[model samples]
Target: MIRRRPPAPLQDAALVAVSLIDVSAHFDAGEPLRMACAVASAFSLLLRRRLPLLTFLLTLPTVLFSDAVIASLVALFTLASLSRHRTLLAVCAMAFTLSDMTSLPSPNLDLAQTATLITLGYTAATAAAPVFLGQLVQTRRDLSLRLAEISEVRDHEQLLTAQAVLAKERAQLAREMHDVVSHQVSLIAVRAGALQVGTADADAKEAAATIRRLSVQTLDELRHMVSVLRASGGRPTELTPQPSLADLQQLVSGSGIEAKLMTDLPHDLPPTLQRAVYRTVQEALTNVRKHAPGATASLHIRHEGDAVRVTVTNTAPTRPALPLPSAHHGLVGLRQRAALLGGTITSGPTPDGGYELCLELPAEGTA
Candidate 1:
């Protein structure tokens, strides 16, 4: 079962009441100065969330002058939970330990005495308990947020994978229908029309015309279905704007890697080739950012003979990369795209521990 945190105001009120009770239990009206300090320490719990250091300083007077240490401990905990500076937290914890230990009018600080040593140890442990608990709370909160973000990204990636699969299947089906089924249907309609024009019998001529009309209607419907299939996933992000060589500059600029692009390709390439080249560079840069953190990349595209070649190269990563969530579909998608365009995709580590992705496509793309 999941637990919910209490409302902020309610938690603050509870801490303030607890602090006040601790103060009242330790101080009497006869010592007005200690009483005043205790009251101030108790009320300072209200600022623990927003001004933890101030709250801790305000409560320190009570710990120094009286035995009411609960308010100061809470303030130390608040500061520990909110602050990231380890040195600051250690100093604050030490301050709490000293203040609690010196609460007496004539404090005993002789470490040689067993009783004094025991008192110091006890006071140190008390101060440490809240600091450790507060640090633990801070770590748990950070871990929860990271887990939430990871979960959200995983779900979104899964959705995109499903959409990509659907789009690929639809495009393949459309190709089959247009290339085979449509060709066969058109031939049948042509043969029927020829029979209608040559046959002498009226019944036979009428039958041929009917067959021709039905075949034509079926062909029209198949055309519509094929168009629909080709246009599938247009609403989704898989294949929105048809990218070309002109967009490569923008893609490299926004890839977050120190990247360079050099291209000298013919401007009359097919849309399929342009998009494939664009995606190859995009995926290579993304991999650099993910697996090869702090790597610089260069993309080179050139036309040689009857083939267009694209290469993306990155230097060695400066530091070890974190274990980012990955499904390993980016390169697989690149391979599938190359196959569809009658091209080849190759990727491997370079000599200097860098990475390279190369794509080669026929000048006359299959698509």
Candidate 2:
């Protein structure tokens, strides 16, 4: 809570008193009633800011009867600085000041001559000065506000630029990691395959076969990472070695949950579409683990003319759901992946209180 300093009431009182004293010195009045009226007009300066137009209206006519020129000048300044109708009020104040000066009694001069002398002399300049100063202050304030808004917009743009640069750097690092790890894992799989074929002992051959399978799975995961990183645009074809619908069996075999695979996939589907299907299933199963633990899940991949449909459904949790911190971006990432492949994805609760995720991708995929 920001506490503003209170207005200085004592200071305002002192200033009003001093202004009354200054006006009294210029007054040529001997009657107490005339002095009281002049003092009242001078003290009206206290309501200048809160009631600027009203103060000006009330004090403007008093200028003819009282020597409160200083107070009236202050009222004009306040009205010009604070009123939305400042231009009209400023014009009226100037005109009224001229009228007030002209109406003052003059013994030796004619009315026109007296009016001309006051309008052309110090009294006219004094009446115009406050309006000019008020306009100057208002202009400065408007300029300052505009500069502040421009500065805020510039700062926001700089922040967005910095975030874009950081995201690009992170994506580059991920691609580099995928390239290095996938290349090494692929090499290991090749060596393991050769060892499996050449080994004489049955146990040794089985161990080599297992190592080769795990290495291939690792390569598939790395390829998925590469696909994600390159989704922005213009990715090199050689950078991606995507997995297809063939890997769905190995994908769900070792999980604790009961899950089944059903597929009628077409041959020679585009790698991008295949990768999208694979990621959709992966993200669905991940969600099942996080949100519906001990659930039975099913993976379905079907061919429909020139497009492929993939669906994953999980039953209600057989055990109590685990308390896992979920960022819930997995489904969002799947939707983006499907969209990049010219596909659409939908997910919602099943009729039986389970969860169902569906994706449909074009066989030819999108650029």
Give the top-scoring candidate (lDDT). Answer: 1
Clashes of each: 0, 0
Off by over 4 Å in 2: 1-15, 27-29, 84-87, 102-109, 114-120, 185-367
Q: Give me the overall lDDT of model 2.
A: 0.68
Worst 10 residues of 2 by lDDT: 231-240
**Collision pairs in model 1:** none
Model 2 Cα lDDT, one tens digit per residue, 126-192 = 7678877887878888999999999999999999888776666656545445434543564466557
Instruction: RMSD for all candidates, in order, please.
Output: 20.6, 11.4
Runs with alpha carbons beyond 4 Å of true place in candidate 1: 104-112, 200-211, 232-367
- The whole-model lDDT of each prediction reads 0.81, 0.68
Who wins the TM-score comparison? 1
